[model samples]
Target: MSAAPFTVLIPARLASTRLPGKPLADIAGLPMVVRVARQAAQSAATQVVVAADDARIVQACAAHGVTALLTRTDHASGSDRLAQACDLLALPDEAIVVNVQGDEPLVAPALIDAVAALLRARPEASMGTAAHAIDSWQDFISPHVVKVVLDAQGLAHYFSRAPIPHARDQAEGQAWWQQAPLQRLAPLRHIGLYSYRAGFLRRFPQLAAAPTEQLEQLEQLRALWHGHAIAVHVTQQAPAAGVDTPQDLERVRALLGHG
Candidate 1:
């Protein structure tokens, strides 16, 4: 069979708590949402669509000549909004659907391809995501940085705010710990990007919210609770910063060398 066509769907909501109307926030002259869609379009996916709950977001996408779908604002997560968008578009069950976060204006096209390709190769995987090795204790311990433990087959075992595979020997100051490969033993930071089969995407909202998911505020946990394997694609480079506040926007602007 031929490779299935993949579609990139960006879930954009205007009422952001950190930065209100964030999708319309100007980034190097263009709105942040538009930049995200443009970056996602560069991926190997067949098409890109912005799933917006507000009319302004739809207008912003239209100004850039990108496809935009109007979804309900009542959806709690971006994944839910994405499923509604897929329904609006009438996508087939076998189609690959990539959920590209709208705040990530600098998201890498290669990373997008990596997640989408992983799902394409693993037909049994219900979902696919990316992760990178955590090099420092700061990132490893930071609750803001979600960490993931993967199984031997590169499938996610667990995702947590706390570090996993604790460095017990390091804490004990064992001589063997000093010689062990500490760098390689660090936990992986889970990237927010994800891809799923259209059929799975539609079924996601119907799945009961897992208790662990509610406690951790991580929706992916629900999949693990449902006994669905999520294949993880480890990447060498780190993903771009998602703009959630003024400081994050400033950092992105500096990276882009905007006036």
Candidate 2:
């Protein structure tokens, strides 16, 4: 399938409680955000731009020859920063904008293409994201691993940290997904990458937080609560881990042959 042309927006913040200046953190000698931008650039996206919370981030991107724009530091979330960026870039309402988190330097280009294509394929969906079938019982029950339940049309029914579609039968450590009735229907692990129409991207900040969102600590629920459909593209492979702490950075650096 041909990947529809889209723009990639990476929201980067300098102040990280876990790793200060994370976006500017070095991995294999390049800033982590710069590495993420480079990976996103490999996709079918027409342009890859960083919506940075600080001028230092902009300067870092410029130094590395990457396009970046400075956004308000006070923005409540990364999505808000991207909303302002959509206006600053003058993106058309119908244009596709994929949100690639700044910390995912090892993100796959194919995943980005798959997500952007969803907007073109499913006009009914207001947004697009990827997920993969859960293969481990441990991950299925882990709160850190988000789970998504999809409808017949592949639209998201709900996203939660709980072990959803709970197997009332699978006790102890049995293979719940391998049960005869669920052989082809395993639970899914939601990937964080998201693609949104530029119009919706800009309006996202105005949506009231959903109760589920606050309880689960997931912002995507706000869109679902406000009656927006998020199409889910099921990928076979799980996504790489995103950096949130110094240990994660070290792991990534080691993987990149710099540690």
Candidate 3:
């Protein structure tokens, strides 16, 4: 599907606690951030700009002929950085912007397009994101895998670390998603990709953190708490994970033939 006219914003920071200078970490012959930008460029987005926290990150993008903006280093989150970026670029309130993680070098261009398109099609939604149905019992029950339950209209009801739509009658430690009532209301694993309007993106950080958001440690709940709708697109399969540690970086490198 074709996406509306859109821009991609990639927020990169140098202060990763697990892997310092993470944006500049070498993946193949290019900086990890640059690889992410190149992948986003392949999408329907008219532009792919890095909203970088450090000048070195800005320079790296410039050297690779990618557009980038130097955002505040003290911003609390990626959303905050993106809000500043929207202002820096002078994007209109109605402009759609996709937030692509700088660490997700293997992020799919088609997936990026799908998210932006989803937002454009759902006017009632302030945000758009993707999820994939969970097939494995381990992933279904794992705290590391975020679960999203959708309403009938394909809007997210809630996102959580715990297994949702709980099958009280079913035995524990089994694949609930593959059986009876659970199969009808299958559990979905949320993807990190997001698409937001420039206006909403700018206003997001100002919204008070929700009690549920604080407990789950999920930022998207803030929007839900404030009565903002989030439309979700369910994909058939999950995308590759983002780099958080040395081990994850090595895994991605091997997948990309860089190891």
Candidate 4:
């Protein structure tokens, strides 16, 4: 099969609960949204565009010569915003579309390529995402960290905030639960980045929210609940932190300066 061109869409919105006007927030002298777009441009994607709702965000992208499309402000999720972007860009059904989060200025180019390539290689998959091994018990228990259970084929079985393959015997202080044998079965931490075929991208908003999705507040669960297969590409490296709060922004700034 011929390689299909991929478009990376950075969905940015000014209104953020943790950090208001986050898209325009300055990080190392540049708006956070523009920084993400710049990093995404390093990928082999055919094009990179900022799908935003605010006029200021549109202006910022224009100033940097980055393509920006104004999407509706009512979109409940970034995936929905990306769908509008696909329509505005006139991407075909066979084209690949990546939804790069605007808040993730530290997103790695290689990770973006991995997700896009996964979808390209698996034509039958409606979506593709990345995951890293869970090394620490702290991360495994953190509700903020989403966990994914993958099948033998590397496709996600489920995603949740709670730990899976629950150690029912751990409550009894079983010595075996802390052994290497049990540690070898550690769960994978789900990364938020995602890529999808234009065909599925266009249909995402139409899918009803699944019960698990609503309970966990995870959008990808809706796809799994609907029986759509999501290929999970495991990577050895840890993904960079997404700037969701002031503290996260400070850490990213420090990393960029030190680099």
Q: Which scores higher on lDDT, 2 or 4?
A: 2
The number of clashing residue pairs in model 1 is 0
Q: Candidate 2, overall lDDT? A: 0.94
Residues 224-243, candidate 1, lDDT per residue (tens digit)?
Answer: 99999999999999777799
**Per-model TM-score on C-alpha atoms:** 0.94, 0.97, 0.97, 0.94
Please give the lDDT score at residue 8 for candidate 2. Answer: 98
The order by descending lDDT is 2, 3, 1, 4
By summed lDDT, the worst window of 10 consecutive residues in model 2 runs over 167-176
Off by over 4 Å in 3: none
Q: For residues 70-153, what per-residue lDDT tens digits would candidate 4 score against the true structure?
A: 999999888999998989988888888888999999889989988999987777789999999877677777799999998878
Clashing residue pair totals per candidate (backbone < 3 A): 0, 0, 0, 0
lDDT of 1 at 145: 95
Clashing pairs in 2: none
Whole-model lDDT per candidate: 0.88, 0.94, 0.93, 0.88
